[model samples]
Structure formats: C-alpha cells, structure tokens
Target: MSGNEKISELDKVLTQFNVFGRYHCLFMFWSFLALASNAVFCSNFVFSAEEVSYRCKDEGFGNDTCTNMANSTAECSEWTYEDPNSFVAEFGLACQDWKRTLVGTMHSFGYMVGLLLVGPMSDRLGRKLSIVITGMLGGVFGVARSFTSNYWLFIALEFLEGAIGDSCSPMFILTIEIVSSRNRLLFYILCSFGYPFGGVLVSLSAWKFTYWRTFLRVIYMPALLFFAYLFLIDESPRWLLIKGKKDKAIKIIEKAAEKNKIKIDKTLLEKMECEKEKSVNFFRLLKMTFESKIILKRFLICLVWWTTSTFVAYGLSINSVSLRGNKYVNYALTSLMDVPANFIILLSQNYFKRKAPLITSFLVGAFLCLAHPFLPANLSWLSLIMYMASKLMSSFYFTITYMFTSELFPTYTRNSMHALCSSLGRIGSIIAPQTPLLMHYWSGLPSLVFGSVSLIAGLITFLVPDTADNSLPDTVKQAEEIGKKGDLKKPAPDFVIDKDKDCSRL
Candidate 1:
C-alpha cells in the first residue's frame, strides 16, 4: 500500500480506540475524583474556620443575655462559640476575626505559586506524573493540617495544601488530550461536575462530623483513593506523542483498544510515527504569545474574565457565612447551583456561542449582585435569593470560560495560557476572602464590588472572538484568523485534520 493509504489507515485505527467508550469513561471517573477533591479542599475552610456567635467570659454576664454586658466594665476575655470545636473558638480568632479570612487567602496564595510552577513542570515531566505528585502532596498536607496545635502551624499547612492541591487543572488537561473532539465538551462537563459534587460532600460531612479537625481528616481521605486509582491509568497518548515516545503511545492505544474490545491491525499501527518539532520553552512560548496581537488580546480578555468570574463566585461562596441564613445550608445551596449551571452551559454553549452566553451570564449575575445592597433588611430572604442567583450565573460563567479559553488558544500554547489565566484568576480568589472584611463599612460593599467588576468583565467579553463550532487551532496564525470573517458557522479551516494527525507538531 502507498504511504498515504497506510497513514490514512493508521488514523482510522486510532479513531477506533479514541471513541467515547469504557476507556474514556473510566478515565473521567478518576479525573472527577481529583476535581472533587479540589472543590472540597478549596471550600472546606469556609466551614472549618466558620464564625460562631460568641460572648465574653465575664462571670457576671448571663450566657443567654450578654447584650447588656458590652456596656459594663466587664472585660471580654475568654469566649464561648456556638460550635466549640471551630478554629475560631479553639484559637481565639473572634476578636481578631480578620485572621480567619487569611485561612482561605493562604490556600489561594499556595495555588498561585503552584500554577506558576506546575504548568511548566507538567510540560517537562508528564501530565499524569505531575498530578500524582501534586495530589499526594496536597492530601498529605491536608491531613497534617488537622494535627497542627498552633494557629501558625495550621496556617502554614493550609498554604502547602493550596500550593499542591491544584491537581484538577492538570488532570483536566489530560482528559482533554485523551478524548476525541466530539467528546471534548461532554468530558469537560463531566469532570466539572466534581466541583458541585465535592460541595455536596462537604455539606454532608459538616452536618455529620460537626468537629472541624475530624471534618478536615475525613474530607482529605478521598485523595488517597484518587491517588491509588492513578496507578491503573496510562499517561496521555497525546503527551507521549509530543515527547516523541511513539512506542509508549501505541502501547497505551493498544491497551485502550483491548479494554474497549476493539481489534487494531498491526500493519496499520506500524505506519504511525511521532513527528518531532523544535521544542519551545516556556519563555519562548510567552514571547510568542505577547508578540501576536490576536493571542495577546484573547489572553488579556480571558485573564480579566477569569479574574472577575472567580472573584465573584468565590466571594459569594466565602461570604455566605455572613449572610442571614444557616451557613451550611447556604453554602450547599450555592454549591448545588453548579448542577443547573452545567446544564445551562450545556444547553446554550452550541446555540449562543461562547461569547454571548458568557456575556449574558456575567451581566445578569452582576445585576443581581449589584441589587443586593439596595434590598431592605427586612427582605433578607430576597437578598439571599439574589445572592444564590448571582452564584448560579457566576458558576455558569466559570464553567464556560474553561471551554472558551481552551478554544481561544492553539494546542501548542494552550496549557501555558490556561495556567497563566488560572494563576491570574487566583488573584481574585485571594482577594475574595478579604472582601468579607468590607462588611464593616457597609454590609453590601463586597457584593457591589463583585457585581461591578463582573459587569465590566461582561462588557469586555465582546472583545473575545466567538468559538462555537470552530476547529481547535494548531498554530498561532490560524488562531489569529479565528473571527476575522465574522461568521460563527464558518467551516473550520483545513488545519483541523492536521491537528488530529500531527499531534507532535502542536
């Protein structure tokens, strides 16, 4: 057979293995576990260090009626918390309540550090290995955090957890790399389901365990299960091919084919070869990204969108403790909003295109959040409803941005751009915890700030090109031409086939 025919046959055989099947499903299940763990760790601090109603330890003050004690000369020294085991009560952070927010800020700071380090590390090592290392480290630190006797020790551990706890993004990239184009959106949604599922797990655990230390220990135990499951999986074939490990890549394909009960013809497999290209370092990638006006615009817009969405979503979530409702139930309800958010994105992604739904979600979410301050205090229920609605829309925007950003960049620099945007997004999260402090000045200041930023971000969404059904760009030049013709349904460029065939070139 001619070389072209042999290459064609190889492509067909690879597709047979790549079809959405048991292999992909299993991969997704494991990936979901990592994502769920991320969600749990990221939000668990909200409950662990939860603020509780407390009063002075003055002997004369009645436990039930401390309202009048504040006016008296009784010094407010020792305190009692509604949840005695909460970090605030245990560590006496009540008078110094500002320190409580730092628990989450430290974790986010660690995540920012991780993003800067891990993305490039994954490129040098392998995606699977990076996840395993980071996951195990995050789990270890998370477990050890429960044992810290001093507040500073606990804070230190939380920082480590934040740094290493970022396994979800790498695992996410791996799932994208392994799946077929047709299954990409479905796989992304499935993996994202873990965030809400983890939130549900957090709520259930908090309700059952009540004690902060035990809650931390129990929530982190799942990380071990996810780490163990990693052994049963293979590194991404796409990454292997990119590293010029053709034999190893084929073995993974063969294993998947065997598990999926498909036969791969040996002759066709022989024609498959990894095509190597000049290796681009992180610095070079950054240089190329900034040099291209199209990519730079998309990058900056996405950075802002990411920062805004994460800021609002996490700000609302952490700030829920201060809302006039049962904190646990409020958090769970907000977390559960992810389910409907996913469905909304799934329904609107194809029809609305990337830019429109994102803009709508941000604008609507902003309006609700901005209106929150104006509501009468008697209508606390109304404010709660608006907060939940804002969370739902922010969650939707967060989910869509993941896919939207992936579509905006070429495969060669996709991971780097994602990591950069995510790193910048962490700035929002880090700032979010501190926003609750604004309530001292005005109860609704945080909400107003979050909403206004989101409104501006939604307006900036117009600058990003719509990527509804467009093919993934394989080169910077192709990515630059994405929206030039102004047709949403423009047939994907001829590079689509090349992207699938020339994985190494990407």
Candidate 2:
C-alpha cells in the first residue's frame, strides 16, 4: 500500500475507536456502580465498629475507653494497653465478635469465587451478559444483606455479594477494550476513582443515617439502577470480533464510524469477512494463560502483584476504622486521599510508565504502614499524614493493576485472564481481615504485617515486563510473539484481523 493509503487506513481505525456509542457510556456507568459497591461495603467496617463499641458500652460489659485501635475494647486503649483478655473478661460478647470479621472474609472469598468464573463466562457469553447477570445478582444480595437478622445469614449474603458482584473486573476489561490505546490507562484510572469517591458517599451516609442496614440499602440502590440501565447497552465489538462474528463486529465498527462522522473502509471489512470460523473453549483460555512458558512467567508476576495489593489494601482500609482517632474523622480523612490519588493516576499515565508508578506506590505504602505504628500518640497530625500516605499508595496500585492486566494479555484471554488475576486478589482480601485479629497477639502488629506485605508486593512488581507504549494485543500468539521477539515497541494501532482469526485470537 502507498503512504497515503496507510494514512487513510490509520484514520479509519482511529475513527472506529472514537465513534463508539451508548456502550461506552454504559461501561462508565457500570464502572461507577462497581466503585460505589466497594465504597458502600467498605463503610460497613467503620459503621459496625462504632455500633459494636457503643453496644458493648451500653451493656456495661465493656468500658467507654477509646483504644488506640479506634473502636476496640478498653484494655487495648491507647491510654492503657492492658491486654485484650481483661476487656474480654469485662465484656461478655466483645471477644466473640468474630462474626464481623468472618463476614468480611467470607465476602472476599465470595469475590474470589466469582472472579474465577466471571471472566471465562464473559469471554463465552459476552461482556454485556456477564455484566448484567453479575450486576443483578449483586443488587439482589445487597438488599438481602440489609434484611438478614441472623449472623450466619448475613455472612452468607455477604459471601453471595462478593461472589456475584465482582462483575467489576470484567466490566473493567470491556471498558478498556473499547477506548483508544493511548487513553486506556487514564480511562481505567478515571473509572476506578468511583471506589474511594463512594467512600466519601458512605461517610456522608453514615453521618446521615446512623444505622448500618439503612446505609447498605442506600448504597445498593445505585447498583440496582445501574442494572436497569445496563440492559440498553450492546456487547463489545472487540469481543465480537474475537468470537468470529464478523458481521456483528463490522456493524459495531460502522456504528462507531457513523457516530464519529467518518467513513469505513470497504476493503478492510471485506478482508476481515474472509477469515475462517474458530471456537473458544474454557480450557483453551486457561491453557493459553498457563500452558506456555514465557506468558506463564508473566501470569505469575501479575498474580503476585494483585495478591500483594489486595492484601495490604484491604488490611489498611478495613483496619482504618480501628486506628487511633474518631471513626468518622479518620474515615473521611483517608477517603479524601483517593481524590489526589486518582488525579496522580490520570496525570502520571500521560508522563510515566505503568511499572514505575505501581512499584513506587507499593514501596511508599510499605514505609507508611511501618511508620504509623511507631509514631507517638501526641503527634496525631503526623500519624494521620502517614495513614493518608498508605491510602494513596493503595489507590494508585488498584488503578494501575486493572490497566496493567488488560494491557498484558491478548484479546482472546483478556477478560478471563484479567478476571483470574483479580480472583486471586480477592483471595488476598479474604485473608486481610485476619491481620487485625492476628496482630492483637503481637506488638504494633497491624503496622508490621501491612508494611511487610507492601514491601514484598513492590519487589514482586519488578518481575513483570514494562508495557508502556505498546499496542494492545488481540491474540495469545501476538502477546507471546512480542515477548519472544523482545519487541517492546509501543503497541501499534489495533489490527482488524479476519473473523476466523479473531476467534483464535480470543
């Protein structure tokens, strides 16, 4: 082809990306809902801590002494680290409050299970169906959680919420799949900002409605609305292309062209249409991820990063309510850090590489976690600053992980592989709540535990290849070939392969 022909070809591809219709908007809306879900669920940690403390005090079983551990029993109070047993002896129900901890862990476990299944299903059934199904399940469980009177029932419902509601990861894959390659990371960051932003909402809700059940209902309402709204959106064209649905994929591309006021290339459509039919199996996707040697290494590195981030991130977030300060003030202060963190993610993607930011953030989080415990009680200002630093790091890692995973995999396994990595992270979350209970036995345990985990997470991040400026891959062969050739060139414009080849790519 001539240079003019190539320029025209590139322009058409760019138009194909830019002119996406309601599906793009729908992706953002669901992202907001995913974030809102995280926020609402997280606020429960704060709300319950306060409620439990107040309940214990009113029963005359536990004293009103405010521990350095926030809403913990009097024996663990900053004014007197008299040992947890003394407080247990004073309060009958205080020690057995493992119900809250168990529920949180179960939720994470549920998320892990959901993550395992959702990604492959998205690849098989399409992003729109996976999202709608999970969103509906999440909404139903969220409301059910509000009505449960038994602790076991609440735990079961929380587990269900985690298991079914993780459509967030798949939704993330679909969102990035639709945007331009250059803006992919920024869009991921922007979409993810809703989680912490939802934290602010949770705080506002707690401030308005003191009861936890009422707050949960309020949090779930938006997800229910989002579910209703998602029905109008279409499936991802990229996913369609990979499924060998050439006609459907071209239709989406044409719609995008129409939306952008550009013309489609008849020849390119004709070329894609000539491809052979291909089938994608669940085992084939898994084999593509782990069966190969080079990509397998990449997969392991990605898994470690996700696990470390989830563990420390949830550990700090859930334990923040127990930190030494007013529950309301501490939560609100930490939640505010998410704004600047989101800003940094958006701006940094323009100027910096993905690996550097993620590694630096994890290391920073480690240091902050370590420092928080040693700081004297008199320096409340300094302590709060450390807490905010930890939060900022978590937020940074969370955004980058989504972008990084999406970029690393081929389009064929993109949704499933991303979901698989995320599912492992949820496993980390399942273990995170245990940190506080585990730390009670050791001195300055929360700090030591989180600090060590963050440090390890940062170091493990060094194992993955940097994918800054690379074109997104559409197939396992392309991704593996890139690694084999060591062609770390910034990714080229997305290829519009034939339909039959697209399935092989998927």
Identify the leading candidate in terms of TM-score.
1
lDDT of 1: 0.76
Query: Can you write out model 1's per-residue Cα lDDT over 434-502, one digit (the tens) per residue?
Result: 987898799889989988998999998988777755555545765786787742233422112222321
lDDT of each: 0.76, 0.67
- What value does the lDDT take at residue 174 in candidate 1? 83
The TM-scores of all predictions, comma-separated, are 0.87, 0.82
TM-score of 1: 0.87
Cand. 2 TM to true fold? 0.82
